[model samples]
Target: MIQRISHFFTAIVHRILPDPLIFAILLTVVTFVLAFGLTPTQPAELVVLWGAGFWNLLAFSMQMALILVTGHALASSPLVKRMLVALASSARTPGQAVMLVAFVGAVACAINWGFGLVLGAMLSREVARRVKGTDYRLLVACAYMGFLTWHGGLSGSVPLVAATRGNPMEKTIGLIPVSHTIFTGYNAFITFALIVLLPILARLMMPRPEDVVSVDPRLLEEPPTVERTLSPDATFAERLEESRALAILVALVCAAYLIIRTIEKGFVLDIDTVNLMFLAAGMILHKTPMGYARAIGTAAKGASGIMIQFPFYAGIQALMDHSGLAGVITRWFVDVANVHTFPLLAFLSSAVINFAVPSGGGHWVVQGPFVMPAAKALGADLGKSAMAIAYGEAWTNMAQPFWALPALAIAGLGVRDIMGYCVTALLFSGLVFVAGMYLF
Candidate 1:
């Protein structure tokens, strides 16, 4: 009866707090109250500034949410799944699937971290469906392999740009320049080796199922579905093209604003500018200006909720910074640890810290203040340190509970399954750490 009551309450919370947006609101309200106590400055004074800054921050949050939603829509389609299956079918064994997925994920992440979540999940599911072994645990493990490598590749915007915000390494290492630090020979070698080594390790670590259980015929029964005769008059392509107009318009406006902002400000423009642009584009493309307005209203109905909660997360960052907790921790890492080994310590520090703070931006924001200074002081190569931090952040995602949420949902797998696969990845990534130490 007690367990039943507990389960009922859990279900109720899941229903009521159905999304992160809801969590964001509650977090913000609590943060607003807590912020009053954290800062040395008075509440009224902080409020005046926070009031001015809050809108822009909220706009950024909304933009992040939109991009994530839009990306999910694009990647979750039937066509992409078909492509992934065709590719995975070539692999003969479960371990091969792990390597293939990890390589693809690393390449994609090398290109863009945001895409990593979608690409990894979609690819893993596709491979799982095709492969003989569809144990939820084994498949979940395969999916996260890609998640591990994605950080070191070209696609990761976080690592490529984090140091640009205020990295001293950018200044000191003026002689050895490249568009991406991780694109270097050393980082590339480590990334490639891990991609290759992880599968072999997985093969050893994971034993094949005792006996393959044939799936039940009834469980796999075909659904009664309609078959469409060829429509000579109508084409899906034509319909897709017609619908493409709105999507294209929306994409162009967002891209234009992003480009303009990147050129002027050196990174993507502030989040509000991008969100407002999308909102405006949505309005204009609709039947009428009023239609556009209504669309914006509907799309942004959740913005208020997000605004309320994100500030608290922000407050968490602020408290850590103001209380000197993050610094003290960083200081300890610097003082006691012998970092003369360069990439090794860099990788280790990155892996450990990433477990606690899963965000590249947040990790950079906190660790950057102290790490860059310590690296210079130790006579360690700055670029290597920066890349190490980036690599570590990405590498550790293999184990981060925060990032595992999406993979868990997509694979219908539990935490235990995800962790099981990552154990091998952890061993493979250790090679990356050692390689980074010696080369850099």
Candidate 2:
């Protein structure tokens, strides 16, 4: 029955889902129509908002692209590849492979979203190389399923921002400490539940034997690096290009900076820090600066999807925020919610807004004004209220192709390839999120 359900969704997704760029374009049109019809903003104003905001995410777009490039380079290191191979070898059967990748993805994601996204994709490919007959798409989706817990984790933008001083909502709710937000009973329940169950759900969603789409090992295999043997009389520039000492010097600088920074401030796993760590690790592990550079060049090819599509999303977010469509949509949910129901409703509202904003920090920026005020008025738990919005954003991402871009790029797959299983994950995980809201 589970397999059949998986097959059903897979069939539908494969038939309907276009390239994610097309999906983004279609979403842009949908947002325009909704804003024009539902809000008081003028059509001319909407176009200006889109254009003005088109470049808004340029810094963010680079960060995302680097997340893919750096993470992939780190994973392509020889030591990391051997480690991945060892981990993959632990799972002999297809079922074990799915479960292992799912669990690993969740844990890594919980630690850091960027790490989880790339690690899961790389690990799944390695697992596929070893565990023949595992459904390759399902492995990638299972890895993505780890994302369900990201917004509740340490690097979660919503909770982290809420805990910081002078945040947008700080005036209203005061600073919500991590103890009250990320480390709370409810957040733990939700995160723990997903971490524990997502793998099982992934295993259950495996396609039937005949329906399985396994990848060829040759396609998944990395090509050998063809560095020529250097003569004893090699030129100074050539020697410097392959210098392990130079790579180690740069790696040490990165490590020293990160360690000192962490000691001075706090252990923050924001994108910049994560990317630096990946680059540093990759440099050291590759044993030479040029080898790491070659790895980065190879990995960067997968990142074109992220580089090209993010501006459209930025435009969409700008339109939704500037045209007041996001607030209008949030108000609809807020109007129906009371103290007891605000958490769930806020979660639902954030889920709706996610399609438009499709960002964690962006969700907080768009929904925080509307949500925090309503929560205070309705006497809802402020921490829970904030996390509810985070949960919704994270939950609905299973259905959205925005965040899936990084994982898909690394997996060498299309948006449709893993989305069918992701839909199933969204359903099962939705129950956990809803139940946690009710209980905590």
Candidate 3:
């Protein structure tokens, strides 16, 4: 029955979903019409909001692009490839491969979301290469499914923000500790539950042997040779470009800086930090600057979707924020919620808002002001309320294509290829989140 349901959604999504770029554009159009039709905003005002907000994510876009390119380059490094190949070899069967990728992805995500995103996709592709008859699409989807645990983990934006001193809600909530949020018994239970269940879910969703859509064997082959021959009389610049020592020197510099920063700040795992580590690792593992550059050139092709689509989503976010549409939506949920029910309602509200504003930090800024104050007024647990928003934003990401962009790009699969399985993940994980809200 689960397999049937998975396939059903897969068929529907594959049939209806357009290219991710087109989807982003359509979303922009819908947000524009809704802002004009449902809100008091005029067309001109909406256009202004869209234009102003379009470039707002320029820095963020660069960070995201780096994450994908650097992560992919790191994975393609010969050392990393050998590691993944050895890991993939342990999975003796297709079902085992699914479980292994899911487990690794979940654990990595629990440590840090950006690390999990790239690592999981990279590992899934490797597993597909080794595991004959594996459902490559399902394998990639399972890897992405592991991301569901991120919000409940250490790098969770909501918990980290709430734990920070002098945040806008700090006075009301009195600086909720990570102990109260991320390390709580309820969150621990949810995290472990998904870690265990998702792999099992992936195994169950695997199609019959004959029905499995395995990866094309050729696609799993090693990247084409980019090694350039160097004569003894090679130019000084050519020697520098291909110098292993030069790459190692740069890698060492990055490593030293990262170590110093970690010592000073204590294990900060933001996107920038993740990118720095991956970049350094790729440079060192590739053993030459030119080799790393070649890998990056190959990886850059995958990032085109993100490059084109993010600004549109940024525009939608701006329109929602500036047009007061987000406030209206949040207030509607708050108006209908009370002390006992506010957390659940906030969770649902965040889920809805996540469709437009996919960034966890961004969602917090928009929803935190309203949700926090209402939680206090209604006598709800502020930490849990904040977490509700966190879980909601993370929970609905299965359906939202925004966060999946990096993983999808790495997997070389379209959104339609994996979202069907993700939708199933969304349903099962949603129950866990709702249970955590009430039982915890």
Report the C-alpha lDDT of model 2 over 47-166, residue by residue, as the tens digit. 999999998989998998998988888887777889999999999999999999999999999989988888899899999988888999999999899999899998899999988888
lDDT of 3 by residue, 1-440 (tens): 88888988888989998888888888899888888887999999999999999999989999999999999988887778899899989998999999999999999999999999999999999999878889999999988999999999988998998899877777765788888889888899889989999999998888878878888676577777556678999999999999989989998999899889889988788989999999988888877889889989988988988888899889989998889888788989998998999988999999999999998888877888889989888889878888999999999999988988999888888899999999988988899988877887
User: How high is each candidate's TM-score?
Assistant: 0.65, 0.98, 0.97
Model 3 ranges off by over 4 Å: 166-168, 171-174, 226-229
Worst 10 residues of 3 by lDDT: 218-227
Model 1's alpha-carbon lDDT is 0.54
lDDT of 1 at 291: 36
Compose the digit string of candidate 1's lDDT tens values, residues 1-440: 32233234334533453344344345445444554654455656555544554443455455555543333333333444356668878777766765666666656555555455546765666666666664435445655666666556654434555535354345533322344466677767776776666555545444436622223334323223211234567676644433435555665776687778778876643234434544444433442333333333433432343345455445444544444445555565666645676556656666766644456666666676677667777777766767677777777766544455555544444454456356556656766657655764
The true-structure Cα RMSD of candidate 3 reads: 1.5
lDDT of each: 0.54, 0.90, 0.89
Error of 2 at 251 (Å): 0.5
Task: Give the number of the best model, judged by TM-score.
Answer: 2
Deviation of model 2 at 428, angstroms: 1.0
Count backbone overlaps in model 2: 0
Which has the higher TM-score value, candidate number 2 or candidate number 3? 2
What is the Cα-based TM-score of model 1? 0.65
